[model samples]
Target: MTAVIAEEDINRIRWHCRRGMLELDMVLARFLEEHADRLTAPQWQEFERLVSLEDHALWQRITATSVTDSTVERLLRGCIIC
Candidate 1:
């Protein structure tokens, strides 16, 4: 059976994805640039697989969350793979 992700875990992942570290930010930036048109099916699938989430759900959470006060180190704490 697939493990059910808790709300807290989702939040933590979102937080990390947004504010983890400079390296992560760079990676995400490159991803966004390369996928600007969202036309690459394989890249889209890979991104979803990497995050262990569906695209729509992940985008919704990312768009809804605010990262005004989070720091790289703080977010990194939450990114640890249990």
Candidate 2:
């Protein structure tokens, strides 16, 4: 079964996707628009963890300069920047 995320949670995630960098914002926004509804439970958890990261760290992951959890890695790979 698909993981069900509450609308409020999705909204919260969207808000957090707003980063200090424009590129990060665009990349994350694209990812959410394309895949938020399709994430599994563990993926959702990893996504939350990802958004909690500082902008630079998150950006590093987006640019493939740093690696993180596999689930987060896979999710980010779906992003256009990856």
The candidate that achieves the highest lDDT relative to the unseen native structure: 2
The reply for model 2, stretches above 4 Å from the true place, is: 65-69
What TM-score would you give candidate 1 relative to the actual structure?
0.33
Q: Cα lDDT of all candidates, in order? A: 0.42, 0.81
Estimated TM-score for each candidate: 0.33, 0.84
lDDT of 2: 0.81
What tens digits encode model 1's per-residue C-alpha lDDT throughout 1-82? 2234455754554454563345445544544444324324444344445445444554443344455342322233333332
lDDT of 2 by residue, 1-82 (tens): 4699999999989999888988888888888888888888988888889889999988777678456568666667667563
Query: Once superposed on the true structure, which residue ranges of model 1 sit more than 4 Å away at CA?
Result: 1-16, 53-82
RMSD value for candidate 1: 14.9
**Lowest-lDDT window of 10 residues in candidate 1?**
68-77
